[model samples]
Target: MRIGILGTGNMADALATHWARAGHQVVVGGRDLAKARRLADRIGHRTGAGDLRTAAEHAEVALLAVPFGAAAALAGTLRDALAGRTLIDCTNPVGPGFRLLTAHGPSAAEQVAAAAPEALVVKAFNLCHENVWRMDPPVFDGRPLAVPLCTDHPAALALASHLTRDLGCTPLAAGPLGNAALLEATAALFITLWVGQHADAQAVAPPLSHAAGPA
Candidate 1:
C-alpha cells in the first residue's frame, strides 16, 4: 500500500512507522519540508518525504494526521488530489476539559468528507494516544487493541482495517461516517478519564461475555 501521512506530529510518526515497517510505501508530508524529511528519515523503510500536495497526489491512502482544527481546511485544499482515495482521519476534536470541540456540528471526519467530497473519509485511530500506537502491537492484558472505525465506503474501511492489522490491532466497524461523532465523544470521555482522573479508560467497559443481558 502507498500511504501518505499529512503531518509531522506524533501520530504521523507512530502510524507511519508501523506502515513503513510493514512494507508499505509511506510518504510523510508537512508544511515544513525539513520536518517531513526528518520524520521520513526516522521511519526509514519504504518511506519518503514530500510536500503535502505531492504526498496526497501520489497516495492510494492518505492519513490526515493534522490537528482537528486544520484538517477540514487542509482537506479542502487537497480535494482534487484526494479524489476517490481512502482518507483516514485520526483526529480528535477534544478541547479543554476534554470536551468534544465539534459537539454541535458534524464530526471532524464528516467535515473532512464535506471538504473533500470525492474522498472516502474514514474515522479511526482517535481513541488512543500516540504513545499507545507507538507500542509494537499495542497489546494489553493479553488482548490486542480493537480500533473502531466509522466510514461509509466499504473499500476505505477495508483498507483502514488492513492498516490496523499492520499495527497488530483489531479493526471494528463502528458504522457510517455519520456515527463518527460518537467515536469522537468516546475519545473525549476516555481522555478525560485517562488524564484528568488517572483512570484506566479500558477498564470502563466490561468484556463482551459480561456485557450480555440476562437470558
Candidate 2:
C-alpha cells in the first residue's frame, strides 16, 4: 500500500515506520520539509517529505495526522489530491487547553467528510496513545489491545483493519462514520481523567484489552 501521512509528528512517524517495516510504501509530509525528512530518516521508510498536497497526491491511502484545528485548511490543500481516495482521519478536535473543541454532535472525521466530499474518509487510531504507537506493544494481562474504527465505507474499513492488524493491534468496528463522535468523545473523557489524576498528559491512551462481558 502507498500510504501518505500528513504530519511529521509521532503518530505519522510511528505508523509510517510500522507499515514500512511490514513492506508497504510510506511517505510523510508536513509544513516543514526538513522536519518531515528528519522523521523519514529516523523511520527508514522509502518516504518523500513535502507539503500536504504532495503527500496526498502520492498516496492511495492518505492519512490526516494533523491537529483538528488545522483541519479546514489542510482539507483545502488536499482537495483535488483526495478525490475518490481513502482518507484516514486520526485527529481529535481538542482545544489549546486540551478541552473539547468540537461538540458531541459530530466528530472530526465527519467534519473531514463534510470538507472533502470527493474523498472516502474513515476514522481510526484516535483512541490509542502515542506511546503505544512507539515501542513494540507488550501484552497486558495476556490480552491484545483493541483499536476501534468507524467508517461508512466497507472497503475503506477493511483496508484500515488490515493496516491495524499489521501493526499488531486489534481493530474494533464501532459502526459507521457517525459513531466517530463516541471515539472522539472517549478521548476527551480519558484526557479529563488524566488531568484529574495529575498524570502525565504527554501520553496518549494506552492500548486497552476488552473486559469479559455477559455471554
Give the TM-scores of the predictions, in the order they appear.
0.98, 0.87
lDDT of 1 by residue, 108-213 (tens): 9999999999999999999999999999989988999999999999999999999999999999999999999999999999989989999988788787878986
lDDT of model 2 at position 45: 49
Clash-forming residue pairs, model 1 = none
Clash pairs for candidate 2:
129-204
- Tell me the spans in candidate 2 whose CA falls farther than 4 Å from its real position: 96-98, 198-215
Worst 10 residues of 1 by lDDT: 206-215
Off by over 4 Å in 1: none
